[model samples]
Target chain A: MEEKLSVNHLLGIKNINQNDIKLIFKTADNFKTVINRSIKRVPSLRDITVANIFFENSTRTRVSFELAEKRLSADIVNFSSTSSSVSKGETLIDTVNNILAMKVDMVVMRHPAPGAAVFLAKNTNTQVINAGDGTHEHPTQALLDAYSIKEKLGDVKGKKIAIIGDILHSRVAISNILCLKKLGAEVMVCGPATLIPKYIGSMGVKIEYNLQNALKWCDVANMLRIQLERQDIKYFPSLREYTMQYGINLQTLQNLEKEIVIMHPGPINRGVEITSDVADHNQSIILNQVENGVAIRMAVLYLLAMKKTENVKN
Target chain B: MKKRILLDSNHTKIMLRRIAMQISETHGNLDNCAIIGMQPRGIKLAKKLLELLTEITKNKKIEYGELDSTFYRDDFRKGDKFLIPNSLNIDFLIENKIIILVDDVLYTGRSVRSALNSLGDFGRPLKIELVTLVDRKFNRELPIQPDYVGEEVDSRAKDIVEVIWAEENSSPEVWIITDK
Candidate 1:
């Protein structure tokens, strides 16, 4: 039988074949080689247009995607609610159709509404790449994080990865859990009692309220950024209480194995989810995650584009 | 089992020379052009083409590189695990250079996909044209067509077309062997 690339369109890392995984890694390797060179840009996707439609506020992800698109020689159009017709109370489908009418080849979108990218993909002929959509998923971030982890610690299979912080609200945590689990890693979601979801254990992942116990069992510790903006919902009583009970600090680091790698989906809260020292440590793959983000996005874009072309030809 | 000659070594060399001339004519000159051979038999063909081109144009600056597509292959699951070889020797930058991607045969076009993937690792070229020694019409999975073709042959799925160079097989001939 012909081997099919098993990528989950929604969850992001579902059933991705080993060959396709190797392809992504290999592509990322190529991008890494060109990064330090004089001409960083490649004319691989010359004349191809990519639109970034961000319904949510973001600085890093939006900019990184734009840079990645530029590096691949793709034309980019950045659309946000602040400047676009979205401010004039335009329907998502109408706005998307208008953008699609311009003959853009792909859309890398981030929406406050969950599964917006999936919905757009179902409706539009253009390729829909999920950048981030509410608390549902941020697949590229998860992919980059996985790439970083794989680069640092080799294959993630059989490795213990503890995802810490607010699991209930973190899109990063959801994505990480799905990605890590798919890659055959033992995933553990650990945070405070109120912050951790009740049914999270049903996802075939181990759940722990105590960070100390989770730290002991894990080879990699991924700290999800505590969304301070969502604090009004009262998931936890106080920031101090959350930090003292569930935060990854120096004391927590000292208690754990030295070989354990540190990770964070950034715009870090500094002392809330993870300590400043741990974040700056040698074992931390936070910065590498940022670098890998571009490559992973490139791989996603390339694969999706290739699939589209194949469909059109067929 | 039966074996039949497809194209001899001398015929192969003559075809490559013709291809080189055709390529030279198409690109105006061999001034800013380079030839990259996909490894193993393709490297031998590339070397022969390089010599033929050099004799034709007397331009020693025409670059030549070897490309190993083992690492970049799309169907790694189907490939032999122990057959992977060392990487290619491509010293010069491929940027803005018209690259002629040379291979032994065009069968499934999957190898060409891998070759493209591998080529991207080095540098982006101005234009890429594929040149293959044999064009076997069977089953093509990818949408890739060779710019230069040596010989076109129709074959069944059970038959394997073998191109034996003088360097490897001593008796230089292209043969199709069908095993049942």
Candidate 2:
């Protein structure tokens, strides 16, 4: 028999154990094989229903989640704040309860508030999957990231993965650090001091200010997009100044004189954080991360649904 | 618990040879046929049977593969235990090719049903036949019967049928474990 996750709701990577990560990866391997088949679909979750509630706008996560749900044969109901009753003055719990009344078994939510998904899980009876909740966590993104790394490197232990770019306002970085640390991978956060969080040292990761030094010391560099929309004040002097100090061009990568996998969680600032050539280079796994997103999400949904069914039976 | 031996190593070999001879007699040309085994347990039987089929017929024209249908199982969320899946390793096209589905035991017939559904995703086969070493009569939940059976035995619901192939320091034999 398959082992299920310890926690029912995926609120954050901090709430999960190492066994849960192993279980998710193990299940994703089977799903990776499934998605490669000629008729790519599974009827594992046919009796269940899922609702994707998004308070923030997203293209990749939204499409990836919708595809994952469809391939699992689950009935999907989508909810966006722009077209919902929240505009008039409905509360978050009330909005979720109304959808639960319609019999949605699980909720994949992306909200602006930090603890919105946790709060929803406490108030509702259904399982909650935090797609992204502000700067707190994005569990699924971290999972697919780790899975992509494992797929490329054969293992996550003892491998160096440097998360570059904005660390101050990124939910992906927080989740990634927790996930990679549990999987035994050494992590480093590199960016301007203003963009890096102060308590990052407490998170058990090295902080690098020099892009070239970070590149020389790492095996895989995961460049995150600068959250320009989330920045209300100037984190650095100027975009050009930031690029000159921290941007990774082809020359910068070649200067290291060794092979290092390049990664970017997309909508990248082309010339600021990473050059176009490096992003499209053979070492880049940006597209593989996107492709593995569906399998990873399918694994998350399938495992969580298994727990929900057992709970009902009990 | 009580254990009963049904076939010894010598008898088991004779039974397998008889099954192989029957296949060679029924279908002389295995060029258009694919020998597939169900995952987890059936793989062992399929491998042994394919080796025997090749030796008896002296024909090297048959293709071999392994199939898994854990996703198409009917008792997904309804079962008490979580379902673990094995990797599917069919690297060939079954389009218009005859398929010989192999398994070690024929009880309940649900796994066979699921395997058939899984095979349709590969391609449309000309015909599909089932082969089993042990046919547990009066235990089928579905209307599935083996095209070639090594032996037919009657047993209670809870009795376990075990097939031991000659591998890893053990001789080949068949046993039934029943509780009184």
Q: In model 2, which residue pairs have backbone atoms overlapping below 3 Å?
A: none
Q: What's the C-alpha lDDT at position A56 in model 1?
A: 85
Candidate models: Cα lDDT each: 0.77, 0.90
* C-alpha positional error of residue A204 in candidate 2 after TM-score superposition, expressed in Å: 1.3
Q: Give the per-residue lDDT of model 1 (tens digit) for B28-50.
A: 55888999998876877788778
Top candidate on lDDT is 2
**Clashing pairs in model 1?**
A6-A15
lDDT of candidate 2 over B85-179, digit per residue (tens):
77778888899998999998899999999999888877799999999989997899999989999999899889999987767433368899999
Report the alpha-carbon TM-score of model 2 versus the true structure: 0.96
Least accurate 10 contiguous residues by lDDT in model 1 chain A: A1-10
Poorly placed runs, candidate 2 (over 4 Å): B169-171
